[model samples]
Target: MKFSRLLAVLALAAGLSGTGASGAGAAERVRVGILKFGTVAWEMDVVRANKLDAANGVAVETVDLASPDAARIAFQAGEVDTIVSDVLWAARLRAEGKPVVYVPFSAAEGSVMVASGAPIRSVGDLKAKKIGVAGGPLDKGWLLLQAYAKKTAGLDLAREAEPVYGAPPLLQQKLESGELDAALIYWNFAARLEAKGFRELVSVEGAARGLGAEGQVALIGYVFRQDFADAHPDLVKGFVAASRAAKALLAGQDAEWTRIRPIMRADDDATFAALKRRFVEGVPSRPIAEEARDAAGLYAQIAAIGGERLVGPAKTLPDGTYWQGK
Candidate 1:
């Protein structure tokens, strides 16, 4: 009788151990690196606030960094599984054999904004005017604008306009203060200016279209190390799904804005509304897919305009740059 009791106890212990092991195996954790003010912050915040990751059967840990560069460093050091960044950066990394893959996060791009009362009615009107260009002269948006001007307006903005390089806020200030007649600014800033009656000379999408690229050329995306993605495909899918769900909520409901409004810290109702509109406009309309041909065409255009400095010498999109799922 004593021997039988000991056997039963050992069997029960083995079953519990197996159950615990299975549970541990089922709950995989994924770590994502994000910047405090980066584009992905709002969506990631939604995911965490609602425990979306847990609902999706994965444990997500968000590591907030000070800036984009800090996020990049953390990702490179294997401290985080994924980071929010531009697709072009992912292409550059893949070109350097970094084994990184890009997943579409946002499709919104900046635009060229002119003062409401300014005489700049078209891209051609930018001639001989002070144009505030963000991210310097070689910025992708500036380069695309340059290409658009040369292609559509039959003039070179580089030679015609006095390109004033500054941050987006400074550019906006200069435009408002009558120092800059026009400014190429991000969508959010452009939206704010539009709300205040500024005229949008050209959108990045419009510029790209004029340059012959088709469809929405996604500028921003989430990049992950290929090894990590391969090791935990479900976790990656879960993250993307959670992010997409958050985006849907933002797109469909005005109530969702209240949750993220604190993070935005808008000074007034008008600014908040404008920012919200811009944010909703930026959400991808379709599921994220690998648009290799479109990406390749846009890359060619960028390479032609920016040369070795912006997109490197390859002038072509790298293989495995887009995550096609498991």
Candidate 2:
């Protein structure tokens, strides 16, 4: 682990420095590892299309990976500078003695879904019904839903309902085929299901609000080693600014999303439009301090449910996990 981190630090320094002779003429490059279909790809396309990263003094490069787990492996081996992940996983790494820095990526927490015509009207209605939960028992969305059900209705999903863990697409299919009474899934899948006429039982974000979060919470983020940030503070900040700029463009313009629709895999116009709306609605608008504070509280809530299997030793977010850049 130490050796790999050293290699990553050195590689990042080289990527940031550019050619010594070119000086300011060359842009600081950031090689980000991402799943080919991950949402980060859409932002990278915008950043590259509009030269947002270059405008911010950085060049954005993407390394395509097969899966999120593959991206993590590549990131740890120093094959790439960063990957998109949540503060929970980052905190787990820190607690286990690895240091990293997190930059907010998106605030799109997913939703709980039921068939549009189903009789299940609320979370309480899901009692004794089968629920398909994507990302497993430790998935942040599932944990939040569990917390919400317990707090709002005193319904313990673990005992009152059956949860079958599976991938997002599979869960969506099962719900459509009547195999699942309700499914708590990732945002993009929820958007797709919405296009197919599914009704939301409750949004993870909405549940979070009921549980006392002041505003939207951003779970996923762009994470890189701390040493890399220390070595290239300006570059790291540039990446963050460029990301925000890409999001701004996508949020405001319908054309930007239209251009990326092919990659979105939206089978129809309704799905395409729904995805665009959900993505725009998820843009983080809260202050950094508030995001950090809410994240700490949410972590405690999930830790109480998932225990050591989910969070390792640290129940709350460890210090220095969330980045407050200059």
Candidate 3:
């Protein structure tokens, strides 16, 4: 199994696909691009462990890549059938005349992490302090923070905080090393930091709620091109069912966690527990229509601050962005 996964990674990196897109059979393979250490792989592990794919009449393959960029590249090159991305990207793609569709994955978002004893208590306290931000200047979480601050605190975090942008790991390290006053990082990294005694000053989810977004917004999801879905509609729908089943297993059973702990790379029991709890907390439970409504609202809030370059070409979410389980 290990050898095969390694080969899959190599094939993904080389833009080679072992699966065919011919869609002549229900068992025709469906390859999903995954980041090697991403949380998405955890759910995929659950799916395989439970044989959910076989139950749903789909043959699933996972292509591991070193980074999100690599995963997107592999997917775009037709080396993988789907990638776990966000509705924002799908909206952007639709605006560009490519009709990508989204399947609800997780509402899990990032947070602002400060030292446990750091003086910063709210967005207002971030003024003139150095902040380590992941996902660059146009990151949705960072932009949401800015919008939330402007609406509630009458301050723009992007302008007030000395913005230091880097990858999630780099930001995590800097926050731990005291080189940063606060770090806005993805949820998994935030979970690790929280386990290490870092404090969450503000969560992106809380900020979105403060901005009047309804329901739990599934910010990220399994995204694929519509043309690809047309090729294997059953496979696509089956993958969704398999994903839902996997989420149910992960959310309800501790037994599954015991099996997948090693893949999580958690250094301590606290980290392991944190990752498990946060991941389950992110499971999408709201109806797709409700989540889509919230996502559209959240998009406008971020776009008002992030503009076209960050929010993408769509001024609003394009129609048919959500798969709606059809």
Candidate 4:
């Protein structure tokens, strides 16, 4: 009889332990990685506006990643479940075996290279002059600039000029101080410097003319791990719902400017207005022909600049490279 009583106590203890574990697991949250860029704010608002996490029974978390390389590394290490960044990194990641699915569009380019004092007026004039790009050989900005040089002016960027790599803030400062001849700059930063007399040397729009700007897309996108997507299908759908709503909200004047001003580094309304006019708006559809072509053009530039040295075939990005979610 005593042994029977001990058995009942052991069973009760096991049941209590199981119940405690289940409660803890239920309260756990999921971690998401993100950048502080403009689109991220839109996403944050949308998620809240739609109450996605609450509806889906999952808590959304965000980590601020400094660079594309760092984001890629984190995603590969499984530290993050999703990210918002350039699709170029996605293609490269899939090619390297750390696979992730492209979810939806993020920010479009109001990004370009600006020259101080207007020494370089057009794309052709960049020959033999130093150009500032973000990454060295692997930078999409460098590839775009090089392709523009080659296709528009027939100048070979690989041998003809010097390409400098630095952070956007530092590069823009150098451009303003006249330390660098030209620097790849976004619309917001470039507008702030325009008050100081910096001018557009070339644009992402112009590059679309020769570099598949219309047919090939180059905008940023939101990406999620395929396994995560599969495991949490309902949660993924909620995220999509939130992003679509954010894109709609971004189409409005008051909504966009209200969000953009705080993110603008320059402390001026005129700069914010100029950037809003010249850079933001029109988040575009997933299958942007010009953007896709620009992406392909980048691949071609990579091919010319020893892409095969890194990955073989060195051809333009084929179909299925981007995922628009199922």
Candidate 5:
């Protein structure tokens, strides 16, 4: 009888231990840093609202930051396991031996906007005009514009246009008030301008191709420490799955836009609808591996534009920079 009792006790302990482990696994959380007005905000918000992380067997907590620099600071301080940033920044970080890897997130969606009735009708007409540039003078959009102009029109925009650097919101305001002739604004800001009767002169994707990158290059992605991804491969896969699911949801359902419209803070219904359309248009349809070659080419284009400051001295896309196999 004692032997039988010992066997039963062993079985019960095993069951209890298994239950404990499952519970712990379910509770494991990953913190991600994001900027308030970045491209990642929409998808991250969708993931949180729909409980996609929980469904995928992981928990994610998003930290809202004020600026891109703040997000970098939070990541460096170990307050966040991942951040939503561009591939160029990820390449720079990995080049510096930071053990960073990028998971493809959003397609390039910025464009140069001009007043509907403005005299500037072509890229060549932008010469000698006041151009408002977002994310500062060395921003990717500005650099791409410079390259596009020099390559296509044989004009140097940097020497021709009076480049005024400022935040996206401020640039948009200046453009509306006629303080600038044209502005190379971000995706959302460009969408808002379109709603207000502004027109796109050229999209970032077109500009990139004009500067020698392959078709539809992905510019932004989710970045994380290599150690964190290695330790929790399941979490990384789950996160990617959840993100893709969110992208799919946004793609098929107009109702999903309603859920995220509040976060966009659009000034009007037209602006909101335009922003939603622009955002959905930029969602990636395939994994990063499928676009590895194009991504490498895009990286080279960005390096050429910004030189050492943007991509460091490497001037090349570092190996293992693109996350493969989920």
Candidate 6:
């Protein structure tokens, strides 16, 4: 009888221990997705350096994509919990009934136009010329570029010229071959083009400022499905914290480029240094009024180009929607 009682006690202890361990395990592991962009590199560095994800039991895995369209498709198929993409793209997804929400202010305005051989001087100079764009008409970068053109030179891009569609790498090659005049390239890739003898036609910083007519406004941020966010509130908050830490480190002029450079890309010091210096002055701490204004301005440009209304989020996000480390 004594032996039987001891065995029963052992069984009960084991059951309790097993239940506790299971609960703990469930609380610790969270799967997240990220892109292979420099923006994500900074955030990943924060996660690893601060040990934030591990401490919170979060396991973050980035899903690499070759194109924006691919990233959108993956997010829609439930392959990723979150993504680092433009606010407009997220807005478009939400409009398509996917219900993704922009993660407040989480972006660096890294979109810019580069002119090959200094032929294009300003955003307006591209009139009657062919411009290379990755996505077709109504592309996010194209829309923003249109807004800049309108604000800077009073030239409406919708009536100006044609946009040639091709991916950045292909477009860069086209520019190099003189097959294309100029291209709307992301800042990271645009910097590479500059290294290869391309010149900056315009920076999103100038465009953002010209369009908003106030503080800086640019499209950049983190986004996630609403259902995922509702299901993982703590996880969302932790992710936001990690993003803030990353941005803070990158925002510093004295940031350890030696550490960050390799993570961004295996580029030479000149390119990395130039890219880092460019972003140091103008990166936003949070998506605030300016982001909303910029979003509104971009939508207007898109509507003008398409001659139809766009199905997306609010014209301007509310002030509280974009805040740092929120």
Question: Each candidate's TM vs. the true structure?
Answer: 0.87, 0.92, 0.91, 0.76, 0.89, 0.75
Candidate 6 yields a Cα-based lDDT of: 0.58
Q: On TM-score, who's better, 1 or 5?
A: 5
Candidate 2: clashing residue pairs, number: 0
Q: List where candidate 2 sits over 4 angstroms from the true fold.
A: 1-25
Per-residue alpha-carbon lDDT of candidate 5 for residues 12-77, written as tens digits (9 for 90 to 100): 111111111122233466667767756677877776677666555656566677788988887877
lDDT minimum window of 10 residues, candidate 4: 1-10
- Which regions in candidate 4 have their CA more than 4 angstroms from the true location? 1-30, 37-39, 49-59, 110-112, 115-117, 253-256, 286-301, 304-319, 324-326
Total backbone collisions for each predicted model? 0, 0, 0, 15, 0, 7
For model 5, what is the C-alpha lDDT against the true structure?
A: 0.75
Candidate 2 lDDT, tens digit per residue, 1-326? 00001111112434322211112236666678877777988987787788666555566667777888888888888888888998889989888898898878888878999998999988888889999999888888888888999987899998899999999999999999999999999999999999999999899999888888889988999998888788887778777777787788998888898899998999999899888888888888777889989988989998999999999999888998988774
Candidate 2 structure lDDT: 0.82
Candidate ranking (TM-score, best to worst)? 2, 3, 5, 1, 4, 6
lDDT of 3 by residue, 103-151 (tens): 8888889999999999999888998999999999888888888888888
Per lDDT, the best of the predicted structures is 2
Worst 10 residues of 3 by lDDT: 1-10
Tens digits of per-residue lDDT for model 1, 1-326: 00000000000122111111112224565666766655577777776666655565655556667767788887798777777787778888888778888988877889899877777899998899989988787777888888889989897999988999998889999998889889999887887788788988899878877877666767778898888778767667766777777787788878878878887766778878888887877776543353556777777877887787876646788877888862
Q: What's the residue-level lDDT of 101 in candidate 3?
A: 89
Arranged by lDDT with the best first, the candidates are: 2, 3, 5, 1, 6, 4
Off by over 4 Å in 6: 1-29, 55-59, 104-107, 110-119, 151-159, 253-256, 279-282, 287-290, 307-325
Residue 85 miss distance in model 1 (angstroms) = 1.5
